[model samples]
Target chain A: MASDGHPSRGLPRSIRNAGWYLLLSVLSVAVLYPVWMTIVRALSEPFVYINEGQPFLPVAIDWGVFNTAWAEGVMGRSMLLTLGVTAIITIAQLVTSMLAAYAFAYLRFPFKTVLFVLLIATLLLPIEVTLIANIRTIRELDWLNSIQGLSAPFLASAFGIFLLRQGFMGVPSELRDAARLDGFGHIAFLRKVALPVNRPIVGSFVLITALGAWNNYLWPRAAVTEQRWETIQVALRSISVSRPERFNVGVAAAIIASVPILVLLIVFQKQIIRGLTAGAVKG
Target chain B: MSLSASAPIQAPTRRRRSSRVREALLGYSLLAPAFIVLGVFGYYPLYRLVHFALYRPNRFGNGEVYVGPSNISSVLADEEFLDGLWISVKYLLYTVPTGLVIGMLLALLSHRRLRGIKVFQAIFSSTVATSVAVASVVFFGLVNPKIGKFGDVSFISLAKADSALRGVALTSIWQNVGLTFVIVLAGLQAVPDAVIEAARVDGFGPLRRLFRVTLPLISPTLLFLIVILMIFGFQSFAPMEILTHGGPAGATETLVFKIFQRRAPGQISEGSVMALGLFGLTFVVTLLQLTILNKRVHYGE
Candidate 1:
């Protein structure tokens, strides 16, 4: 469908294409405007984002708003807490999902189809539907305002099982048989053979889960009242809402909160997109 | 672990039966942890939803009393709940088409083979990296009329009683546009070349090809995106929670927000009822879209 590379292209077509390009450039700027303004205000003078007279271009820059924001708000601790929670959830989900995925993909069990359907059925049940119920469960377990509350409900991902099962099913049975003949039990085969063979899917799942856990706000908001248990996003929102005077610091906190995932995006661009589109296909 | 019990079960197909039992044992062991977690967090909530919806917690020192299905009507008749549902519909109307059109437009623009197109694509999809909470706060800060561009304009948040929802809806569109863009771009790329070539040979203009041949062929992707976006829009909470906090006088208090706001024992029944109502709405709409759209999608069959 793309036929514009050749020099034989007419001037009319070129001008039209240039028009499209300009529109795209302008729209991109508009799309990036909110983020740009936030980052500029964040790194620039504090509260300049709120002032009526502050220029679009920052006049004076304060590079330490991040430090100040982190120090003042529960941001630093929140970030560390979020990282810890994401790590716990990621590791727990990976292990559990991998095990379950192996069972679904390779093994035959009684009521296997029924169990699989039940798991997939949960995909339709968004957490919003069950937030109250889950909160009650967390309270009952005395896991509220703690790391377990933050990560327990997310320890098993139905999406992970579905994604990895596709990968495992792609594994040729001959290879599995050979590994089995070598006395590689399920765990042994999974680690040495299956995981390596399905590294991309595994990597994608890890990044997606990390991103989800890092960005989770609703559950954390519902389950945790203590500031000690707040994730960075939730903490940032509380700061912005309860204290609008600290808008700049809230922006700073946002910059800090998104930094790790931004780094991840830059590093693992293709894997993130793969994970996203995998979700689209599943939907 | 239960091999001893399995060993005692003699059958005509003894060998096959024994391996079946052993595999079942292994499978159950592997699945137990995930299943337990799912049961507690996933299925249990659904069960509790029905239970919670059927009872009303008394306002006095007394506990919850069985109210049968009355909670459903109470929740449905709640002024905030109804407003919330209305705002959610408005949100879906506002965000979905805007996002879909912007995404489709950008996809068509980027589908052209031009130099430095990847840079433009990256810029278009950059917002995909941001979380809902982050984007909401950024917009929240920027919506101040004093310094920020969006704030300078009165139409953003001060347009009317329902303007807060509009403001939050703008953020949702901004944040979710990248997702729609990426999905639609993939759809465009997957669009077969033969049809486009045939359209070109048939003397169709660029715009005509886009409106007729391309969009029709890519309607499946568009339909999938619409369904997902509808679900996202109906279920949107974090944006409203962070940006509007269910108001400038609760204008943006969508259903999820109402569900969240109703936390007291007196309101928990309504919350559960609203949650169940929303769950049913989302479930039905999703199934409806999938069934309706799947038949009409041009699969190049």
Candidate 2:
């Protein structure tokens, strides 16, 4: 124990033990309010229900309105587009990061120290710093309104490389040498050894990257101006901005926008937190 | 703990020239694909921003007019940039402490040995699902002037010029408090049970145990949260753009938002300069954090 364990010198234990439970229950309601309302209004009829009974409650649920919102907002197309783009970015970044990390951890090269230092230093460079020039570059390539534009700038990440490198380097060199003696090439070793051992890191990084892509607001909005190429984030913004009258539809769009990632978070909360904090705690 | 073992002892492989060449080749090849992508996006864009900031590119991406570093000075003097900086500071003030305090409160409240405690923890952390855009839109709907949930339609803070920032603050806090909660919960969990029990044995009261023991023990995580929250807060833009479009006036525009929201065509250089300034700000803040908080943050045995 690092600290003195003396509980009796604090506030009355009886009051704390009794009151905390009630305080937590009440606090839960406050925290859940916006999310609950979003789902409720998303399910309710758009224009008519706002004017009618139980103004805030989710009674008179209507799937028809959500269906109409999906069609009208082109949310289905945009959602699919976002999903495909997210998947590509996630998978590509992982493969690329894995390769780069393996090199850093196991292979020898000239200026290896300099290269690693530079890459790590780049972690401090915020994406916003380069957004201006990058968007212009995207424009010059005629990549706007395309998956290439959406996925290109993010196909590699310093953060990903740094993370995978930490995990790969943590692996025992003895195990690696033994594998090589048994005729495992780098590719085979990575697939069988590195990937398998660091599955938590890989899994968590996938979730984080997927979340980033799904929630992309600025780049997607700025890069792809065409309505056809718009992601759901852009679509949701335009929907809410254009048709506050269609409030329920707007809420439905937001809900539909968030569901997949929400499921991922619920299922992989531990790994996601691990992935997020990996750089923070140790780096 | 496993980190101590990573000092590479070169395997007893052949050290001949051919083998060395092959090893180097393989290393570079592995690094090549990612380096190419990073070159195009990360390093290349950073280089271009510096170049762009030094010169004014014409309407076409082809020609350039060199204006030198005066562009940065001009941007610094500009009112919008200064206003954006102020807004950024205000956002940090509102969202950062509130999120930390609320999160710690949630953590402490649930750190009990109760039944189904995880259910409450999960609910508390559930807002992590709402992305910036999604959360901003949700808050927008909630506080919309008419048909809005909270304030009377006419008195909606989001619709007013002076109070729109506060409205955005609520959205930011709602989205971020979950993250703080999770981080703090992890920190609290890491505190050794023996420490708590020892405090009880020493006649430490409930609040004393918390103040003199648990909070101090968990301060490292809290400090870590502060660094992240400061960075995240300074970089906030999506809520401003999504919720208020940077205002009922320009009331909610923060530094990152200012970097992208151009009022004129030649403002790319200006925005680039501001972006770099924001980067400098981020680096300085991080340095400040490490120097200031390093003394107090506990590294447990």
Candidate 3:
């Protein structure tokens, strides 16, 4: 089965391998073009491309755009803000979802099925539809100009709880019974037994949820009225859309904003890929 | 004496059952904080959406504000709202199929056991990490024509509505293609070699095999992707706000964009109605797709 090509007998496997490599190289170029262009623009003068009229490559390379973005807090301040917000949201969401999931998976309570189903139903409703009312609520709470407002509403995600509940249900019943017999309380059993065993799943959920929070634009934009508290995504938007004429500056800002996510993807590509596949597998 | 001892044993059993109930109640208590948050933020706003959409506050009395029949009529009657709906529908029509196609193409290309499949897969998927705003900005640079990478190309200006939509769609499709590929590739890998062998033995050609076997087997996955993609398409806002700004002439103003503008902190009446409209549109479309795809997809053993 490995070498059964009838008409391609004249062509060696080495030649075939070369052809595949060539095709892949062309693909690699196509995939990397946008990223390469972004880097080139980010490192160049603000109006160099505009002045040159048709510079495919940077005419004058400098770190001025990064400097500008950092000074403007688009890169430096917004990046830190986004990171902090993402971290807090991820941690809060994880803990909440894990605890709720443990209850659903292990505890026997009245109306358990009904409540769990109700929680899961929220997944079907588009959160965007509720944005207006949510904003109003946030304003009322005086959380309109703070990170607490930005992250609070979204910290209790039905999707996260659902995913973790499914993960928790896969644990054997005997393990829980054993922990119970050993005098572990419900919360203690969950933290010491269920959680430690499902580290991979917990890690996957954290990465995916963090990505969602990091990339979230609408809620943060709607809730955070103060410009100083802007996340990197919102900051990027302010730079790009608000200053449409400054093509180089806008592009530079975009490059700065995207680099962190790109770096994260590179570092966790394998886990990310696995996690993505896992979502599709059961569906 | 034995009967008396047996009768007494049941008392302890009942007490133990009560203790179990207490423990379970404790678990529920521990879970209360998260549930309260979910209820107020997640469930409450959804319920309020209907109320807000229906009742136009006395603050802005156009008497035409009640939700009963007038609000629905007003939503359907507004020309700008209709236009926004049209644009969003057009976007969905273009984006959903295009994403699936491009995803399938990329997945197929990289699915083979080749030296660079991993590298290509990684690069193709890099777009998944980019937010909508970032994608919009990158494409904005590309199609600037006056100062873009393709500035020399005559067809690059975003001033034209069609061109703007096309540009946004292209960037969107590029960013989304990676995730789609990753998703479909998972489905493809799950196809058993024995099934392919059997199909080959039955004298079915590659194309036939793909359509008849591979597609049917992966229908569940494809359906999931389609539903998710259409939902994402309807929710598209950043691209419009950042890339085209509803463009050359409100060509790319999606329903979500209108909802955003209306609900902009101060004016709540029109925005509430628009938000309700957007919600209805998404809900109906999602449910319709789910029902339609239900007949086609078969989750198998």
Per DockQ, the best of the predicted structures is: 1
> What's candidate 3's i-RMS value?
6.8
DockQ of each: 0.50, 0.47, 0.45
- The sequence of per-residue lDDT tens digits that candidate 3 reaches over residues A1-283 is 2111224346887887687678767877876687678777766675666666535577677777767766665478778888988998999989889888777776666777788767766665565777888888888899987878888876777777877887777777667667756777656767787788888888878888888889988888788877888888888878766664555677777777777777888888877777776656554
Q: Indicate the residue-level lDDT of A141 in model 2.
A: 95
Ranking by lDDT: 1, 2, 3
- Per-residue lDDT value at B272 in model 1: 87
Question: In terms of docking quality, how is candidate 3 classified?
Answer: acceptable
In order of TM-score, best first, we have 1, 2, 3
TM-score of each: 0.91, 0.90, 0.90
Locate the minimum summed-lDDT window of 10 residues in model 1 chain A: A1-10
- Tens digit of lDDT per residue, candidate 1, span A20-128? 6787789889888888888777766655545554466765777777888888886768888999999999999999999999888877777888899888778777888
- Residue-level lDDT of model 1, residues B1-301, one tens digit each, is 1112211122356588687788789889999999999999989888888887897766674877788877678777878678878888999999999999988887777886777888888888788899989988887766644344576465676334646667778888999878888888887777767888788779777678878888887777788888888888988888887766776777888888888877555667778888887888878876866575546543444
**Predictions in order: chain A TM-score:** 0.90, 0.88, 0.90
Cα lDDT tens digits for candidate 2, A1-283? 2232226436676665556668778999999988888778777765655455326577668888667778889988999999999999999999999988988887777878887867766656666766777788898898989999988888888889988997898777787777766878777888888889999989999898999888887788778878999988888888776677777888787887888888899888899887766533432
After superposing candidate 1 on the true structure, give the runs of residues whose Cα lies further than 4 Å from its correct spot: A1-9, A12-21, A44-54, A174-184, A279-283, B1-14, B59-62, B145-148, B289-301
The TM-score of candidate 2's chain A against the true chain A comes to 0.88
